[model samples]
Target: MGAWVTRALRNFNVENRAERELSKMKPLSAPRHPSTKSLLQEQMSRHPEIEGEIARKDDKLLSLLRDVYVNSKDPVSLKVKDAGVLQESKEFRLPIGHHFEMMNIKSIPKGKISIVEALTLLNNHKLYPETWTAKKIAEEYQLELKDVNSLLKYFVTYEVKVFPAKDKKALQPK
Candidate 1:
């Protein structure tokens, strides 16, 4: 029994030692090729005339770019004085007031409502569904009736619930 136990432990130690050595060994990397920058330098050295041609093309390109920059500096007028007057209509006006004065007044795209308006509409629909129906909300916010119906059906405000502890002793602070 002693001989058998010693032989088993010796085999286990040899196997463990081999595994430890294998784990410590690093993987070998593949051979590398010459870098692109070095290859480009060698090619440029062989063609001396190509260097002169490149310089000439670069100078021509710089001149063209300078001409464009000078021309762009002169502001092109949109002739706002000659343009047609903007029609004042309810359709053009925003349903909500602006937080700040806008420089340019542009009409909002059709079938869109602000985040604040959407929340208010949802809250109203939730509290007073009969008064603030999908039809009323659609007319008030200038949204499609189908879209308003979908919003009310799918979206909901956060609902919080609190549960009391089963044991009165557990509620007491340590």
Candidate 2:
């Protein structure tokens, strides 16, 4: 056992020394690519006409921008008189009574029912379990049968249980 322990320690130290030597060595450098500046210089030297074309386009753009700036400086060129006038010109009032009626007429999307509809469904299912089974409810509401089964299995309406007072005297009307 003593010889085995010494041999294990010596092996561990030798492995650690190898690792340390590897860590001390410098990493190999990555291959270099020419810089963007040098590449651009080479490209410009190859195509001198490109430089003249770019200058001409830049001058045209500058003149157009100057014209736009001058036109923007004259308020009459812009259709909007005052900022407030622009806001006042458009009507933002929402349609009231009739819009709600139209919305109610819209069909409910599949797999979804309104809160009132959900409550009604739950109440009906509870009151008439046989008549409003999960299959029937799912068909009527356009919901998945599994969802209806889960809903029926887990959820319940508010049940108010009235517990009598602990003492009989407390129950008597004052």
Candidate 3:
């Protein structure tokens, strides 16, 4: 019995040592993908307006991508207020696919958090913070306002209380 326990402890130590050694090595990125700097440059070229927006919000967008997106297994979304104007801008259109060799991404992936999920994340008080607005979530995640509005309306109809009663009723289903 004592030999078995000793062997188990030795195995655990070996595993821990292997993990530490692996941690010391540089992390591997997605295969066939451009480096972080190049990817940001490509994204900037695709969305010219986005050039200063990310930097203005979080200095040096590269760090944001590396620290937030690259390391994350799941998608990362932002929730800045007043993002509709940016999305509605003419610069945010689909890229011209006629003359591109490795830039097939027409639209960025936006993370979706259900109304129930959002509500669960927020305080139950009637006076929810302004940051919890659907518009803010849509902006942060680069989602369409119409889609977000429709989702909010649908959830509200189902009697989910993410927003104030008056606000919920006021939200157009379009």
Q: Which candidate has the highest lDDT of all?
A: 2
- The local distance difference test score of each candidate is 0.73, 0.74, 0.56
Each candidate's number of clashing pairs is: 0, 0, 1
Cα misplacement distance, residue 94 of candidate 2 (Å): 29
| Tens-digit per-residue lDDT, 1-51, candidate 1 | 999999898888797899899999697766446677687678789988877
lDDT of 3 by residue, 49-136 (tens): 8856755765576676777744446433343433655666544434222333455555532455434334542332124636657676
Candidate 3: list runs displaced more than 4 Å.
1-108, 111-129, 157-174
Q: 42-138 in candidate 2: lDDT tens per residue?
A: 8899998988886575768788888884333656645665766876665342222233464644444567776667788899998999999999988
Candidate 3 versus the native: TM-score? 0.21
Clashing pairs for model 2 are none
How well does model 1 score by local distance difference test?
Answer: 0.73
- The candidate scoring highest on TM-score is 2
TM-score between candidate 1 and the true structure: 0.37
